[model samples]
Target: MAGGIFVVPLLTLFAGASFPTAVAVSLVSVIACSCASAPQFLSARLVNLRLAAVLELATVAGSVVGVLLVGSIAPGILYGLFAVVLLVSAAQMLRPRRSAQPLGSGWGERLRLASSAPDAGGVDQRYHVGSLPIGLSLMFGAGTLSALLGIGSGVLKIPAMDAALRLPLKVSSATANLMIGVTATGTAAAYLILGKVDLVLAGPVVLGSVLGAVLGARAMVRVNGSVLRVAFVLVLAALAVPMGLTAFGIEIGPLR
Candidate 1:
């Protein structure tokens, strides 16, 4: 979730990589992380394959569009947009969620968009999917952001599934994890065609991210959803300010 948001900035500010190179490397790392973690989520039955496939169509289209736009947009403008996205995600994470209502009659109902998972008590808990259009719209944006900024886009995907589609946090997270590799593959192809990907840098990043993701996926099953939300908020808030400043060409002492 956070890899690209932090890694791109660190690479550019400290490691002296160009923005495009950093972005490409970040996408590579995201793909590695997704590849490592998603299988485990799939084995655990946490990933919603149907939901992921449905949303991926929109995401892929948006990623193509974003990749086309990347060359035309200025790096500073991209950074500013990234900051805005991070801030919005932070606010969304901080917001309290209501108990999701049943999947009332709609496209979701017609599609049989309900799922079940075992709860803490070992009883099957059923949840319904809602707001298909809204979720798809947000997913498109998430895909665009993922391509434009070189992220996994979990920041947007999680909120879209949780808030718009009325999915449980764990399901949303796992599904997002599964979807990211596919999404990044599309963007990475574009980057490779553009000669933006730095294999030297991406090599180490991919290895580290894959290992970290495996550990994180195991930890995720044990953490409370509320704790995850708080951590998401804090991480995004911390990234947003520095990125917003960087966008305006302001360098805080030593970080530049």
Candidate 2:
């Protein structure tokens, strides 16, 4: 799951396994991501409980629905949608994010649902006010994508928080990492019930992902993501073409 989202799911596909095998392997990666990023999220004070709670509501709801719909939908249709999402994500990552400004005048309505939290810099900052509906909708979308693709929506979540909700990249990334495990819980249940998981293939992927997540989290603090974002976009673009072809039932490969 971790490598698929971070790099590409193509490797797992090359292993000649079913979709369940890929999701099962990806779940381990999700666990590792949570374990690796939770500490930093706590230390940075970016948990945003209210926002997470609201988002979870939507995510859980959507995941349940997604599971129900999975059996009815064609695999090609699902993969085709995922390929589109991947391309959009790649584009979003490549562009520079607009800076977030404080919501000053809109403080009254927001104060009821929104709250203040300190950043790693020790300043209490204002977050979304009265935006639960919008946030929940976003999470619902994330959950749908998760169930459909077997990839965590962290890529989408981070960008949404940073771009749509006006959150700092650091806080957004931290919060996104924190939320993945919870979101996965809902979808994983659905996947499990549907028999869409493989233990053996999942084991090594999870092990490698946890170790990799720890390194990725640490690197997030020191590295300038500008270059990384560009490279990631290029990688995503390259992957999208083949994914699109595959989704349309045009087989285009021999092996990884």
Clashes of each: 0, 2
lDDT by residue (tens digit), candidate 2, 1-256: 2455642355434676655466555755675677676886677676766666666777767767776777788877766766787788887776677665546324325534455668657889766533344556677888777766666776567656765566665666666677777777776665567776676666677777777777877787678778887887887777777667777878666743
Candidate 1 lDDT over residue span 1-256, tens digit each: 6367667877777787778888899998888888898888788777778888889987888898888888899989988988887888788777776566655538777776677765656576888888899999989988898888898777778778877888876678788887888888987887788787898898888888988899888887687978887987887788788789989998666766
Model 1: what TM-score? 0.91
Regions of candidate 2 where Cα sits further than 4 Å from its true position:
1-8, 102-130, 193-195
Summed over model 2, clashes come to 2
Clashing pairs in 1: none
Q: Where does the lowest 10-residue lDDT sum fall in candidate 2?
A: 104-113
Decoy 2 TM-score against native:
0.85
lDDT of each: 0.81, 0.66
Q: Could you estimate the TM-score for every candidate?
A: 0.91, 0.85
